[model samples]
Target: MRSRGLFSRCALVLGLVFLYVPILSMVIFSFNNSRLVTVWDAAHSPTLKWYVALAANEQILRAAWLSIRIALVASTGAVILGTLAGVALARFGAFRGRLLLAGMTTAPIVMPEVITGLSLLLLFVAMEQLIGWPKGVGAVTITLAHITFCMAYVTVVVQSRLAGMDESLEEAAMDLGARPGRVFFRITLPLILPAIASGWLLAFTLSWDDLVITQFVAGPGSSTLPMVIFSKVRFGVTPDVNALATILVLIVATGIGVSTVWMRYQQRRRERDVLLAAAANL
Candidate 1:
């Protein structure tokens, strides 16, 4: 048992190393003073030259902006659509076409990315031919494609949260002469907000990191950050790429940290309010 435990510990450490070592290396190299990313100079100290260069890089800036814009819009849309779907699935149990709706909502999770991308591409083609809408693949197409799959992720998060949620609060509201819509907005929505926020962030990350679907759906002038990174890395590695990656890492980490702290604060505030309310009742 002792030997097995030691082996498990070693395996876990090794897995973490495998996953994070490259990311660590990239972060470290981003500070390298040398022009070449891989080569380190003993004589020269780390400098912010590459970071400065990254700021000046028009292509990278444009791509990053495009990516952020798409992610923000797509995530919002996904969260709205997913929340509606989740509410239907959780609150309206066993309604007509429920099975079909459920299957469609979950299908994107299990489906291959290639298949999803191809189908969306074909869908865009068909839509263009049929209605002459969208004109051609661009930011609109990519955003729609991202929303399609990201909605599935949001749905799963919200559905799981709803499954374990205390429906009593909503029921109590309804019993106290509140309309169903009022109860949902005041009670259900508040309770499930954390899950919705989580789903939104997750959907944003998925959309931001997506390459395969974006590659298929994107047309000229709509290249995202990941697409740009992929193109740069295909030829060879550059220090600018490292600097760009480090910037992205820092941005993502800061967002996550802020969100986590804010969520914890909100949770504590709610708990305090509940305790005060109970004391008042007593």
Candidate 2:
């Protein structure tokens, strides 16, 4: 038993160390004075050259903006569509082709990214040939590609929440003479709010980090942030890249922490309301 406990403790320590080491290195190197990005110096000696250079580079800023735009739109559409799919599947998905539908939903996750990119590229080509819409690779194309992959993640998230949810809640609302729309809007949607929030965030992050699909779909003046970062990293690491990554890490961490706390507070408030109602009945 002692050995088991020791092993578990060791594993936890190692896991934390493994996770933080790279982040720490990146932060440390962000202040590196050396142009080679291999050496760090005291604050007084360190140079702000990379940051100045990064700010001067309009291409990186443009790419970052494009990436953000694509991620936002894609995740929004994915959440709306994925929520409907999740609701349908959890409540009434046992009909014909349910298994096939689920398989198709998850197919992109396991398939090679290169194939996914190529397939989307081809689909876009076919669409252009047929409809003459979506002219070519650009914001619309990137967003469409992101939505294709983001939907699976959103569906999986919302499906998990729906499966764990109590159907009796909705039934009770209905029994009280609430309309179907009212039951959905007032009861089901409120109950699954956390799940939906998580799904949206997950979808957004996935879209933001996507590379292969974005690479294939991106065109002139439409390079997303990852493509720019990839091009830079291929040549060599730069302090500006480190700074950008660190900024993303901070933003993600802060958003997650704030959301988690907000969700917990809401859950607790609901519990309190329920308890108060029960006490009044008593």
What is the lDDT for 250 in model 2?
84
The segments of candidate 2 whose C-alpha lies over 4 angstroms from its true place after superposition are: 42-47, 260-282
User: For model 1, what is the C-alpha lDDT against the true structure?
Assistant: 0.92
lDDT of 1 by residue, 1-282 (tens): 999999999999999999989998999888888877788865774878888998998998999999999999999999999999999999898999999989999999989889999999999999999999889999999999999999998998999999998888888888899998999899999999989999999999999999998999999999999999899899888888888888878998899899789889999999999999999999
* TM-score winner: 1
Candidate 2 lDDT by residue in tens digits, 1-282: 999999999999999999999997886677677766766566544556667777788999988888888899999999998888788788874788778768877887788899999999888989999999779878889899999889988888888899999999899998999998899899989988888988998899999899998889888888898998999899877778987777777887898799789879999999999999999999
Q: How many backbone clashes does candidate 1 have?
A: 0
**TM-score for model 2?**
0.90
In model 2, where is the ten-residue run with the lowest total lDDT?
A: 40-49
Off by over 4 Å in 1: 1-3, 263-282
Cα RMSD to the true fold for all candidates: 2.4, 2.5
